[model samples]
Target: MANIFNIMDFLWAPWRSKYVADSSKSKREEKCIFCEFPEQNDDERNLIVYRSKYAYIILNRFPYNPSHVMIVPYRHISSVELLEDNEAQDIFRLIKITLAAIRKVYSPDGFNIGINIGRTAGAGIEAHVHVHIVPRWNGDANFMPVLSNTKVLPEDLETTYVKLKKAIEDIINNEDSLDH
Candidate 1:
């Protein structure tokens, strides 16, 4: 008889290979993605939606849900306590902007906003601190993840990125107009 769990292991989640491979690399060998992404010029290719003075918002390449993103500071620091006052403020501001943008785009029933500080605490990139904002809908926690150990996202990353990018830009522009 074949073990169901063994069969499940062969589930075709090709996109997860990068995440699995990266996680296995030693700290000395791996570059901080949060730090390196913003340094690049291609926002669309990098999945970066918005940028502020001290922080930026980037889509999670491996997402728990559609339109999931992280608010990351430019400076690579592992802990919340290490954040400068300005950086902290910028991150919080970006969080608000991101929430609004997500609402405009996904209209999720709720959200899971969090920061994992260390490897033990579930920080995938423990060397760089960032905030994950996962949009949640009613009954989103379905059988796929529990039964098959997989999450089926309805929207592709590129489409989600385009919609979110436009929403963020529009929201920021509106806020700027309101302030002026």
Candidate 2:
């Protein structure tokens, strides 16, 4: 008998499809997941690694690489220029911390931190402004992404979450210990 359903046949990502579709809804989708997630106070469930004054860090649900995270301003704004003084400061601070966390966890060779302003610019949630901190290793952008248009994350999101969460805890709890 032949294996009729091969792994290459499809990508099992219904949640991603739904999440993207939900982001496009006009009803605001229950006050925005970003706005609602922090209030929930469930770091593990929400995949939030750390929370600061005006911004927080959460692991990308559909990550391009391991330990890929986002620095999101609490207030929902699409444009980076509109970020408040405090939000901007906190977001930058968090980005620094995110880099450390990723280094402590994944130790990627490089990084790609950016923001996509609008839906046209590759923002899945264009209504919210968030900074992406994507870790990059040697040859990470390999055959799969280029040929199949699919990214193959070596580990699960939850595993990455746990690893990064520990790194965040180390940084936050022992701020003085880490190199400044």
Candidate 3:
């Protein structure tokens, strides 16, 4: 009898190649992207939409959904427990802002907000602690991730950044007006 299970198949996802390639690098040898992206002084190119004293909001280059973003502290740390009071507060505040912005722009049905501290816990950058805010909609989960380990996003990152940046700015401005 022929070995039917031995046949090979390929799923062409060129966009995921960078992530797959980077996965091979030793964590210690790689510079923390959360640290490096901020220092580059190019917020738009970096996909950083908002910055606060202790934390900032940046879009996830590889996203589970259209408006996925992360709230990252300026100081690099491995766990939330290591966060200083100000950093924690700033991150929390930014989370609220991010939520409002995503709601205003994407109008997601719901959200998945989480922090993955260690590599075992799903932290892609184990050296840095950040909170991810993934906007979710009803019936968003599909066969792609289950079958092919792929996610199909409708919009590109640049478009998402533009819409989110504007929404964040508008939200901040509205809050400022309310405070006055």
List RMSD in Å for every model shown: 4.9, 6.9, 4.7
The lDDT, on a scale of 0 to 1, for candidate 3 is 0.86
Minimum summed lDDT over a 10-residue window in model 3 is located at 6-15
What digit string (tens of lDDT, one per residue) describes model 3 on residues 1-180?
A: 977665355435555666646743736568787999999999999999999999999999888789899999999899999999989988998898889889888889999999988878877888889999999999897778656766789999999999999998898878654233
Report the lDDT tens digits of candidate 1 across residue range 78-174.
9999999999989998888888889987899999999999878978889999999999999987677656767789999999999999998898888
lDDT (Cα, 0-100) at 77 in candidate 1 = 90
lDDT, candidate 2, 74-97, per-residue tens: 898879999989899889878877
Model 1 earns a TM-score of 0.84
Query: Would you list the C-alpha lDDT of every candidate in the order shown?
Result: 0.87, 0.83, 0.86
**Stretches of candidate 3 exceeding 4 Å from the true structure:** 1-28, 146-149, 176-180
Q: Is candidate 2 or candidate 3 better by lDDT?
A: 3
**Residue 84 lDDT in candidate 3:** 97
For each candidate in turn, the TM-score is: 0.84, 0.80, 0.84
Model 2: clashing residue pairs? none
Report the Cα lDDT for candidate 1. 0.87
Report how far off residue 2 is in candidate 3 (Å). 23
Ranking by lDDT: 1, 3, 2
Error of 1 at 96 (Å): 0.4
